[model samples]
Target chain A: MRIYIYRRFERFWHWMQALLVMLLMLTGFEVHGSYTFFGYENAVHYHQIFAIAYLILVVFAIFWHLVTGEWRQYLPTLQNIRAQLDYYLFGIFRNAPHPTRKTALSKLNPLQRIVYFGFKVLVIPVMGLSGILYLFYRYPQQYETLPFGFVGIKSIAYWHTAGAFVLVAFLIAHLYLITTGTTIFSNLKAMITGYEEVTDHHPTSDSQKQEEVVI
Target chain B: MKRIFLGLLLLGIFAAILIPSLFKEPYRPPLLSQLREKYHKKASKSADHSKFLPLQKPFTRPQEVTEACISCHNQRHIEVMKSSHWNWERLEYVTGKGIRAIGKKNILNNFCIGIASNEAACNKCHIGFGFKDASFDFQNPLNVDCLSCHDLSNTYLKASGGAGMPDPSVNLNIVAQSVGRPTRNNCGTCHFFGGGGNNVKHGDLEMALFDTEREIDVHMGTDGVDLSCVDCHTAKNHQMLGKVYSLSSMNRDRVQCEQCHTDKPHQQTILNRHGIKVACQTCHIPTYAKVNPTKMEWDWSTAGNLKNGEPYEEKDSLGMVAYTSLKGTFTWARNVKPEYLWFNGTATHVLLGEPINPTQVVKINELFGSYRDPEAKIIPVKIHRAVQPYDKKYNYLVQPKTYSVTKGDSGFWNDFDWQKAIQAGMQHLGLPYSGDYGFVKTEMTWPINHMVAPKSQALSCVECHSRENSRLAALTDFYLPARDRNYWIDHIGKGLIIFTIIAVILHTLLRIYHSTKNQARRDV
Candidate 1:
């Protein structure tokens, strides 16, 4: 039975962030001199545009998460984390059932919650801060007064590049994990349409328990 | 609902990408050129010099003309006498080497060596009368050849090998009467012909800049702004506002681009930021010696090679002197790309009698700065390399007497003998020279400050930002994007990405195989 899981705003934010991150990576790597795609100047220009868009999206998403109390979705828990790891490591090949169940109230598995929490608090913030420093490395003194007193862009650039690599790795793993749902396209469909088909057996009791725990 | 979100996302992406590119960059006013025009108009002299009775008198000697100039403008020679142009040396505070008097008189160069024993010939451009030897009095006001610089007449010529005297053929009275503001012709008389030939020493400064078009030089172009040499090199108390790093040490009196154009001259904020670290000449003067070829190499070791016991000259296909039996072999290049380095406007010169490593290429003058120096900017320079004589035993460069007024003298060109030339030169300077001498490689750098092309010819970002053949490839002290990257991060990052892809593929296959096996079992 299909049930509403991701809200309208949540789905929109997810897709938009995905598109912006992809664009940032494409242009950012080009600016890094990894390869010539958009040309150096154009790549820097587009990268800055995408970065600003992403920052705006982040501000809105942070506000939305706080107001709607969807921030709890990324609150990490140890419950069934070992089982989640086991499921990916050994159980899935043996046709074993998933260790943690997903519901409207507790939408993420223990492992997903931890990974997503870290990605939100750690990886994204690091990327954002380093990128901001890099962008304003040498702003015109006439236009804006920046407090940053960085001697060189060496460390900031390296950290930003390293964060980009990590983000790309996470993206590849996340894309693969989408196929690990009950059906191959189920999670993908869920993200797109704001719904997922949950098995009907004891759904009311499971959701009630999840709601209590989440609250 | 999904379709609406997808369409909106696509539209937003397209708009974001297209909006910036669609709008052209705002037009920036040509403020620099406008300022140049203003200065060019202001450079006009108020007084017609020919009307003065003192200048109209018949003058036989160049010194007599100086006496005539001081007769009216009495105190002007005081300012002229105090200048480095009169003394040919200045007291400079060299880094690590305490306050030392350094200039063309004492400094060693890779080119025609030094002026100690070759003054009679070399002092043809010295801006004084009778600077033939060490005995020339610096205190004499009449010795100051004011007509060399102040002469508006094109006919004022310094006699070759006459020790800075005006040529006898030049009508001194005419030159004296025509004395006014110096033109491109006046400055180019000495500067354009450095190292005994046109465009030989400084590759960027050549005869071509005297009346060239905007393509060759924007500032000195007669058809353009028509600015004289004194426009940028503004003089106060006869001390000009510029320093040649080859002859100067301190950061003072530099004629910066910011003197006319502000530090933030570019339209884009990014380019303005770049201006802090990159000099204007680094981008604007992309290539120098645009018209005439300049000497790149001079090998004095191959000198004394006589063709039928007579010094003969050989020319290349371009008619540039390739070899002369008197001065040895030379290589010339036109439209040469400049090498880049960080300079904070200070320099350290290799003075005479200084010990040098004979095996290594000696830097006659080393420009001081690095990437970490906040005051430093990357500047383009033309490095003139040469193989010149040095004392093999004492390990010091030997100054050779390369010229003489009369034949059969001890000068290198006259006698074609290095021993006699070195002996005469060292004895003149009162320095010890080992009887034995051998040629050692040396280098001298001339900062390219002229022949600025039109704005459109400025180097684009990719020219120095790319991985291969970057103009700043030699300057590897700091990390430059596109030109530099961390090796381990790149390799490991790529490795992890590939490893993750392979693992994902393997995991997917395993899951598929297991699921298919279970389905087959259920069907059976």
Candidate 2:
């Protein structure tokens, strides 16, 4: 069986999207007065425009994911979840065996499915909502008979800020996990070049049980 | 292909440059009023004493003028002679005792401190004559002499050292009227500061000028009705009002409310008949400005507010707002007075309403002056800060002991659940939390109020409750400064540090979870 899970456009979009996101985070923090890099005013201006670009890219990415059936990859499943856990925790460390193998037909292991599923479903939406709120917070006129006492710009501001911290954490973890691929640079290279070198033959249980190192 | 590549490269550069500058904020320093600038720079030069006294060689005052002043003010001849004014040509006071910068012959006044730190307040009055800019002898050249007040007809000056003049108070008030009158503006020069407190400016002089005639802003007010300059400035102290930059002879004690008005008897009789016990000033005229006349009222006729075919409880038979004995939004006008007014407090974002312990994550930019957003509204734009890490609010106890679960009768806090109680406590502190709002499975609310309850440890009264009991001190992450902007800024900076810890912790937890999984795999 064979499958082309990610189209060329999908891979190109993903790599570029990731690069832009990292750039945005760096500049967004500086503009938020976390530190000075490109000077305060410059940082702030860049953050605003970059945020717009991010929003535009997100729209395109969402459309692409929907039209090309790529969004299905993120739909989560719990099949053999325990085996996947065991594979990571115990199996891989001993170089014993991979309980679930990667294939063109099924790219992710169970654990990868669950984690990436969560990233798409929960983390991305939360950050996106907060960021959009932060940007468009100016519109609502903010007036009433007694100036709505219980709510304020503060609560909204805190939400956006808290959201920013979560995004920063996600980026850090994502960067670290990227290095855990076949080679230190393999995942990064695949993202850039749209091609990954997979083991030519599928490793069979009989071969692995006999301690064979199948090329 | 090469040309196409070059075109794309140029386009990329153009896009990068255009994106940031398009959203940039323009740089303009804070606006300083012309008068304020003049008050700082050529302050004494514009105070032409030559107009009061002619430019002449040192000559004694007109004999009759001295006799004229002596007629009523018979006491201080010897005191005047011994004063630095008497030794005007002598090398004393200027470099010796007055101006702190020189330390000698600088006997400007009773001010013991310099202008920079505000140890004393003579800088408000009796400032240096032609200070350093004139390149004259600061030690003993010019004196704000006794003659500057008493010599009414003739004036004298010694370009280098001395000058003499005599004047009457009324004439000076008249002449000084044109060249910056000694009115509320001059009073603000000193009284706006508490002379020597930590918070520098007293009144919010930075407040934008108000032109509206009426607003029922019951919580604030300034000048109106009988509450005029006389209400506060009831008396004049030193008969001689000092030079423009110098301190005035303001009789502070005489300015108290009791100093002038005899307690009115008619107010009590009316109150007795009505069975009400309250000060007439309390309800009738809420602020200083309302008590003073000539203050205009906003239009109530156009407001169209009426009740039962009448103009409501606001007016009496005379069509005046009964309580104020005038028309229009008298209540809001009263609130404008700085003395009687109070900030709604909530409007200022003073109350910490999110992340239960707002002090945990302070605004990093606020302390370092780093927070600003070019994309946001320009009304006092700033990088609104939350607290950061390394703060002392880790264990702050929050309140609001109950919360609603959802819209149904079942969700109300009628039943006592431990989860509800804990959630309530967190809510009071403005901590981060998620719960069911009506029609929604997941809704989050950050802290709206914070109260770190005192540890149950017994203590001396002064230990925990000493001076820490402000009306909302328990709820506040930052204290309102008694005197300094920097103090307030620093306090806010310190309070928001706790959140940085949360960020760091979250970051570490994720890394740890992944690392642990990776470690476990290798061990197998």
Candidate 3:
């Protein structure tokens, strides 16, 4: 049965963030001299512009998540986590029934919660901060009249590029995991249309009860 | 709910960065005008020197103007006469041996060789009258040319081969009437034209300084601070501060930027800590000769190339004189990166009689500094390289008479006779010449203190500390990251990170394996 899971704002934020992140990675890797698609200078300009837009998106999305209490979707829990791990590693290949149920609440089962939380709290902030510092490192107003030393731009570039690699790694894992849903297109369609097909009808957890009120 | 707090935190950070910047004041150089006014009291409440009776007369010789200047300002000529400008020399205090009188008049340089037999052409920059030969009087107070330094009209033209006088065509009366405080043009007439042309001797200085954009030179730029020469080289009693690298060390006259800007110019402590070991110019002036090309290499051995027995010249891609039959092959470059060196405010000059190693390329003057020295700072210097004649037997660099272009004489440029020119130059200095001379490579290092670019245009960190193509690649005295990396440390650091990541992944895999087995057991 089709159930309303992802909200309108949640789907919108996801798609927008996807587009911005992809654009950023494209121009960013070009700037990092991975392979030139756009020229380096143009890549840097586009990357900087996309970075600002991504930051604004983050601001609005954070507020939206708080107002609607959709942020609880990523709060990790031990319940059924071992069963979910067992399903991914062994039970899934043996054609066993899935151990965890996907409902309106608890969208990310345990592993996704930890990875997404770390990305949002740690990796993304590092990328944003290092990128912004590189943009204004030799800012005229800051250093022209009074030249002073800080951590050098070389170190900053190194950190920003490192953070980009982490994001790329996360993206690769995320793309592969999207196919591990009930069907290959199920997870992607749910993200796009704010609806998912589920077998269960009864609400089980307190989070499920809370999500029922919102729906 | 937690996301609202996170949103507020990010907003606060953005506000913290933007709000203070709106009210921050621009930098203002510390003013010493009030202190200077108290110490060196001005002669008048706007007293005009043009109305003075002695200056009102029609002047013929520059000496006549000097006579009028000293009549009222009696102590001025005496102070100038005692100065190195008028004397052309000073007692060497930094010498390892006992104090000896050394000056530009006695020095032998690779450019236009020396002042001995070529005094007529060279005396155009001299601050005295009739320095045409060794016998020229130095005791005459009236011979001091005041108009060269104090000329407000900017019409005073010191012609080559004019014996320390302004070219005769200039109306001396108007020059005398127009006396005022010296400007950059007044000082740069000789300085900018040193080594015969603009941007020749000192690569950092050029005619571009007269009207520059802020990008080329922030301090002297028209749109910027627009500072004159004397602003930094402050003169007290006509004795200006700063000693040229080619000249003897004038330690007392060295001007530090801290005199105007405080010791801690920056708000950040990281920069203030570096101020002790780094010069203001080291970071400020990333490159030299930004506006026009400066001579980088001069090969006098290739000189005397003639097109049908007549000297010819050729221009390069940048339109700089690439090949001159009279002066030889010259390589000029603009936006040239300077070599870094440790300088502890002292330099050891190679005087006229000093012995040199004829087998090796000699440093005409060596700046004395090292990492070990507590007072030393890494400074930027333009190392002017040239191939000039050296006395092989005597093991000394020769001062060839290069500019004396008489019809049948010993000038090197006129006849290309190295023996005659070297002999004449040595004889004038009262030193014995071996008559055997060979072309030897020589270098003179001039500290780059001008043409400060805006900080945005200043060199990025990688330009100095990168693995390849770094400006300071040749600086082996210190350790820098990427430029000088410890292999073991790098490997260990990377190895630790990689090992930790692999261990975490292995631990996660093992946990998943154990958990799956337990789940299967429960189901069975």
Candidate 4:
């Protein structure tokens, strides 16, 4: 059974992105005066700079995904989703079997593929655009021109604040599911050093599925 | 390898943000200071150009220059002081009229009629030694002396340690708020900007506050004469004072714009990129210049010029005449919009707005001493009064308004009760009076119904009844009533250290809590 469907680069990007996002969310809220860890102004400046870097990384990731054709793997499908949900809910707890197999080509669990794809294409982009708009959302001193009189300042501030709320919600969900990985640190270590082992009893790869004589 | 690279990238980022910033102190936070005591005092105190007030510091000025004009243009100073121009000085204000406060030093002199605090006000009518002084830093210096051209001699100090008269032949000053010069920089000293790299915020005064050819935010910038700021904003040494017999009650316009703009064309209705019809002054409204109008505060040195035994009439050698008339009349139009007029009584940071219509009127029953009220008048009574935040003079400002005071021998309350006074003032002004500012103050009503009433008046007992916008000076945010900033900074540092220790303890507790909770759940 194949053990490495997630490439070294993809795993590296995933965990690096996760850690940075956690740091960012923690610091970003502190900056907004929600709470304070670092001083408020310092947190704000750090959040802004890190946000800029994250945006640059997104650009790089998007280009990499496009070049690698890995983008196609996340195209949403209803196929096998119901069965996959049932396998995790009942079969896996009963020790019957995992309904899905990990392969060199398809590494993501069905739920993760759909959710991650949605986040990358929709949620993150909204956060990025709204945050960028917020940073420069000030009236030019020389021009002093504004689209909306005073409302312009307030509106952008609202949008950025709303986006931050959404991002924070996502972080809470992501952190709570750390136990879902094969072992406590297995998924985390795979992201860092780029490898994870699979037991023979579990169906490990689609190549093995293809080699099955009857199916 | 990737983690190593990530570490290097983080290091690079830290260096980018920290190193240069540390060296240059590039991270200067916005100055959180609002107008404080030193500034408030400066704004409240004004220079007496008309009277002989001692200069704050020694600089070159001629005492006798304008003496000749007193003979020819008698009473020019007195007349000028009564005008809207003198409004900066709060002349004729029952407490103070016409005058408003801007910065303590940078008094926004309303030189142009029909245009409040516009560029022409700065470069045209307002004149001083800086216009001729080569060393003046136009950006910061409150250089324009109110008396520059008004003096009969038309005298000015020259760079070469010489005092010379403006060419008497020249007719400086705008020709009565009419058609004049069109060339750019005409009012650029406060408006048109771009001279000497003197950037302007809005389209009010040009770059220079005084002669700032470069910029208002910067003082002492470098620029050449070919690009001289005065090219368009040409002021004539007209040797005259404010407009006579106008409600405005300030100096006649100075710095003739016609020399450059020979033609007069009003608004040709057209739309700009924003799809709004335009006028040259629409975006360039005079409000910018007028916002902090400081020119009107009375120079304490010239406060009460009493000529007790003499008659009210005085004549200058020029066959000019003057009177001690205290009648203040005003017209409401484009330039003379409703605004607060601070009196030279006491300097306070508080702002009190005027109503479009003043609810009362007062006549000069007498000047220079004991007088009687000829008739009953509505007065504004104080309801509630509070001291200014972080009083700069750091002295007690006892407001005997909302709170109480003992009356002499009269067991009954004082007849001039503050609560009654404000109610009466509010009633007269047709305003719903509430709030208990005690000291009673009122205003004589104006002629018209201004839409934005409370937004435009002087600080009165009745007006401050409502509270809004809780702001504090920057100093108050930190520990203060202490010595210099260093001690306060140390206090903040200690707070940070305590906070860090608490954070570590809290984090350890949280980790323990979560782990135990997880184990209990698993056991169950």
Error of 3 at B137 (Å): 2.0
Tens-digit per-residue lDDT, A60-179, candidate 1: 678768866899889999989999999998999988877876777778999999999999999999999999999889722323445775446888888888889988988999999998
Cα miss at B373, model 3 (Å)? 2.2
What TM-scores do the predictions have? 0.92, 0.36, 0.66, 0.40
Candidate 2 Cα misplacement greater than 4 A, ranges = A1-8, A24-46, A101-105, A136-154, A157-169, A179-184, A200-215, B1-524
lDDT by residue (A1-215, candidate 4, tens digit) is: 22444565576567657766877877765544445477644565677767766765666567667866778778776777887777645443444445665554566767767877887777777677767765545333223556543444344544555555555555554554343455556655555655555556455356555533211
lDDT of 2 by residue, A133-155 (tens): 55544322224222233334355
Best-fitting candidate, scored by lDDT: 1
Check candidate 1 and list the clashing pairs: none
What lDDT would each prediction earn against the true structure? 0.86, 0.35, 0.75, 0.35
Please give the distance, in angstroms, between residue B487's alpha carbon in candidate 3 and its true position after superposition: 1.3
Tens-place lDDT per residue, model 2, B72-107, is 445544344433223222221221123222211221
Q: Sort by lDDT, best first: what order?
A: 1, 3, 4, 2
> What are the per-residue Cα lDDT tens digits for candidate 3 across B387-496?
98888888887777767757467887787666787888788788888878888899988899888887777665556645667677776775543455444444554455
DockQ, candidate 3, comes to 0.04
lDDT per residue as tens, model 4, B1-524: 54654455556555655664476533333231322221212222243333433222232233233332343345544554343332333332222443644321222111111111112212233333323222334332223333332222222222221112233333222111111222223333223331111221122233333343222211112221222233333334422222211122222342222243222321211112211211112222213223212111111111113355322434333232222211111111112222322111122222222221112221111111110111111111111111110111211111111111234311112222434433433333233444333111122211111011111132221121112211112112221111112333334534554565564456445545665776788899
Judging by TM-score against the true structure, name the best candidate. 1
lDDT of 1 at B468: 89
Among these predicted structures, which one has the highest DockQ?
1
- Whose TM-score is higher: candidate 2's or candidate 3's? 3
B37, model 3: CA deviation in Å? 18
